[model samples]
Target: MPFEAEEIRIDLMCRIAEDGHWHGTLGLNVDAQALWRLGLHPDQPTSVVNGPSPPAWWHTAGERYASRHAVRRRHDGR
Candidate 1:
């Protein structure tokens, strides 16, 4: 089985707790970074992203986006 790799973006709101660690959430009603991807999959239930507010910009890590992103499972790309 051959597979190709691609990247995806996701956003989440995180907070520091009294335990001295960071915590994030994707639940409803929060200030999460929020998804701005294309190919609407509203029924797909996002397990993973918001990238390139325009879907054509900042598609690589070299741009240093502050948001969290998902990459190919076996990818070693930068």
Candidate 2:
């Protein structure tokens, strides 16, 4: 039998560099059960891995000078 997939929405507040100055928010659609297995909760504060920066000039500002040091979860005014 085919099973339906369950998805969850999460908000991430990422700090792309060590300076902790530049930050951005991202919305993610992830597998609900997988997130639960990994101990992730909705509206929870957590750290995530950094991906490659976008090719735009403004997007490269934070990544040009320094590497992506860390990422964190953000609360959506809940």
Candidate 3:
């Protein structure tokens, strides 16, 4: 099968931990820079043999939570 790639955005509810790590519910217009730093960049493909599972601290909680805030916004709606 043939696949075509395109740019996309991601969103997340993020927080910095005391240990200097991050934790939060992942939504999806997540900054490419942030994603790249976190090892979650879509442009760079990865596999389980060499990479870890998506961080447990950040994940989709459920259908309802995911549905609520997984979008990219140009302006702050916070």
Compared with the true structure, the alpha-carbon lDDT of candidate 2 equals 0.52
Q: Which tens-of-lDDT digit does each residue in 6-50 have in candidate 3?
A: 333446687886878676665544456545544666776654123
lDDT per residue as tens, model 1, 1-78: 011122333457788878777766654432222322432346444653443343334445535553565553422334
**40 in model 2: Cα distance from truth in Å?**
0.4
Ranked by TM-score, top first: 3, 2, 1
Query: Local error of candidate 3 at 64, Å?
Result: 16
Supply every candidate's count of residue pairs whose N, Cα or C atoms clash at under 3 angstroms: 4, 0, 7
Off by over 4 Å in 3: 1-28, 47-78
Estimate candidate 1's alpha-carbon lDDT, on a 0 to 1 scale: 0.42
lDDT per residue for candidate 2 within 1-78, as digits (tens), equals 011244546687767656655767778777755554444546444564223323486557667645656453463333
Measured on C-alpha atoms, candidate 3 has an lDDT of 0.51
- Superposed by TM-score, candidate 1 places the C-alpha of residue 52 at a distance from the truth, in angstroms, of 30
Off by over 4 Å in 2: 1-27, 43-78
Alpha carbon lDDT at 76, candidate 1: 39
- Each prediction's TM-score against the native? 0.22, 0.22, 0.25
